[model samples]
Target: MLYIFQDETTSTVAPARLYKALTIDGDTIIPKVIPGFRTVEIVEGNGGPGTIKKLTFEEGQHIYVTYALHIYNL
Candidate 1:
């Protein structure tokens, strides 16, 4: 069985800053802040929409992430 999880939160940070941190700098930031995360590698694409990244943990567990971006005009 496959499960999908989604979450939403409000932040005081600007959207552009948040986006850069999560997408551009995440590989460096995630391992430092998140325990058990060994490294994050881009397995495919150029870190854009549809890009796939692999997160390897200290215990040899791996998680694959595919990015999808949604833009809304306000």
Candidate 2:
């Protein structure tokens, strides 16, 4: 079985800034703002297609998330 999810939102920030925050600087920023996230590190690949990131949460947290992001140019 397979599942996919999508979400859309509106923001007043410029597209470039938003992209930078979410993609370019996310590893550094997310763990700081979001509780339970102990660290977000790139386990493999450069910051491009096929990148695999490991997100380790604080101890006792029930969720363990890992992302293998395949980015493409639109």
Candidate 3:
């Protein structure tokens, strides 16, 4: 059997602008941070749990991921 591991990270950004950026313009924001994707879109949910997001790459391939939106103050 093979095991896969995932790492968790806490990214700190200006809370106010980051919120607006993510909620308003995630497609434009994420690609700048994560390579290999040109654009992203919310396929479901209203910025809550059980949300589905789609990432479209430059080569025309698409990937889907389920996401949760949870923000905390530091």
What is the lDDT of every predicted structure here?
0.75, 0.86, 0.66
Off by over 4 Å in 1: 1-3, 59-74
Candidate 2 TM-score versus the reference: 0.81
- Displacement of residue 31 (Cα, Å) in model 1 is 0.5
Query: What ranges in model 2 sit over 4 Å off?
Result: 1-3, 72-74
> Tell me, what's the RMSD of every candidate?
3.9, 2.3, 5.8
- Please tell me which predicted candidate would have the highest lDDT against the true structure: 2
> What tens digits encode model 1's per-residue C-alpha lDDT throughout 1-70?
3455667999999999998998799999999999988888887878776666777777655554444433
Clash count of each predicted structure = 0, 0, 0
lDDT of 1: 0.75
Error of 3 at 23 (Å): 7.6
| Global fold similarity of model 1 (TM-score) | 0.66
**After superposition, candidate 3 runs with Cα above 4 Å error:** 1-26, 60-74
